[model samples]
Target: MQSSSKKETIDCFENAIKNLNNVRTLYTENFVNWKGVTKDSKEYYTEIIAEELINKINNENIISENIKPLERENYKVPSRGKTFISNTNRKEENVAKRIDKMECGELGHILYYQMPLKPNNKIKKVGKIDLVSFKKDENIVYVIELKVANKNETLLRAILEIITYYQQLNQTNFINSFKDDLGDKYKKVEIQPAVLLTCDCRAYEEVEQLDERPYLKELIKKLDVELFSLSLNIQSIE
Candidate 1:
């Protein structure tokens, strides 16, 4: 007969397996549902849940040997100092982090976030790319900027920032540096700039009505920049 503790361990393992399968099913169904909805029409809640599910799975400790089990008496929360930043900047950073964590399929890989850009050998830091990702199969690289604002001016700023990053990345030295970081696999990828925004439904609806819409679209086309938006009310999974 097995000991009580051993029996409990086995039971836990079985339960975990069942939960994993259930989550897998949920992810598959949700992904299919997401595909059916047009990009603009997709709800923030749906995207949040789908992303949370992926994060949950990735957070699971699959390699038991790599993680040491702690005794109840030994477990304690670590102390950390509170870091402060403006609310607006925090939101922008949070959105960028979310995009960084997302899985981009087998061919896609996130290259870096907050990648520095120093133009023309200038000592001052000009700007940083919010997120950069590469798709190996397509030989394409994405330079993304995350914006928490719905304002047209903010949108334009993000577009300019990404364009600057793109230009810096296209430089020979910068390309060589990236090659060193990502290896030779990304040697010949085409870079594309993009702006990602988090806005409420009303703001999103008003975007098309903005006077800058035509000029924005023209600039996007001219610069080969992609525009993407997500709803602002994405809830955190507890």
Candidate 2:
């Protein structure tokens, strides 16, 4: 929803976020009761809520020039390293950029550098997914992992992460933890796991080699993660 006034838009967004927090709290507290709530019911409720928020914001008619709805199916990834910044420790940010561009085209709404998958207050847990996108009301979002495609620590860790995200769909609590980041802008957002193996044939071969190792393959297969090999030439930095 577009708003004509910037002030109204910001206010509307803030109010929407507040409402979302309340709704999630209600859901969590009444999980057993709400368990019977069908997906369509949830979607309809959220859509109405979202529309109200948008109208509230638009009422002021002070539109922010920067606010724009994501376009669908014409996404492009920016030159890495330069345009996009990543935590030096992980390459997920860069990999996600590529996938978003590939899947959503330029019209994707990408949320990058998300808070660590495990919040600071929680018990020690592996970090967060690299990116999250709301692709203009599309059915799926790409949960990307960027790691070297060899028999290394990073690759193995990424595989685990992809599965974690996949399993997250079933964990209402864990998914709610992300509500702050996701906000209430999009409804029916579903994450699809993807691993962008950022390495050449040598490294790619290393992963393929794991095929013979039934255990490793089994673990990966369970997660239903995809593998995309990016050339080392795919500079993450500009």
- Residues 63-165 of candidate 1: C-alpha lDDT, one tens digit per residue: 2212222112211112424423334435666655555535455326666656555433443334567777777677766677766643432343454456655
Residue 5 Cα positional deviation in candidate 1, in Å, after optimal superposition: 78
- Location of the lowest summed lDDT over 10 successive residues in candidate 2: 27-36
The residue-level lDDT of candidate 1 at 163 comes to 60
Q: Compared with the true structure, what per-residue lDDT tens digits does model 2 show for residues 1-238?
A: 2212434433444553454323212211211111111233332222232244345335632222212222122122234344455556344454555454343343255555332443234433334556555455554555665554333333334554555544433334433544555567334566667765655523355466664434444445544666666555445442
Best TM-score among the predictions, by candidate number:
1
**Alpha carbon lDDT of residue 115, candidate 2?**
27
TM-score of each: 0.49, 0.43
**TM-score for model 1?**
0.49
Per-residue error (Å), model 1, residue 231:
5.1
Angstrom error of the Cα, residue 144, model 1: value is: 1.2
Off by over 4 Å in 1: 1-89, 104-108, 119-122, 149-152, 180-184, 201-207, 210-212, 231-238
Lowest-scoring 10 consecutive residues by lDDT in candidate 1?
A: 68-77
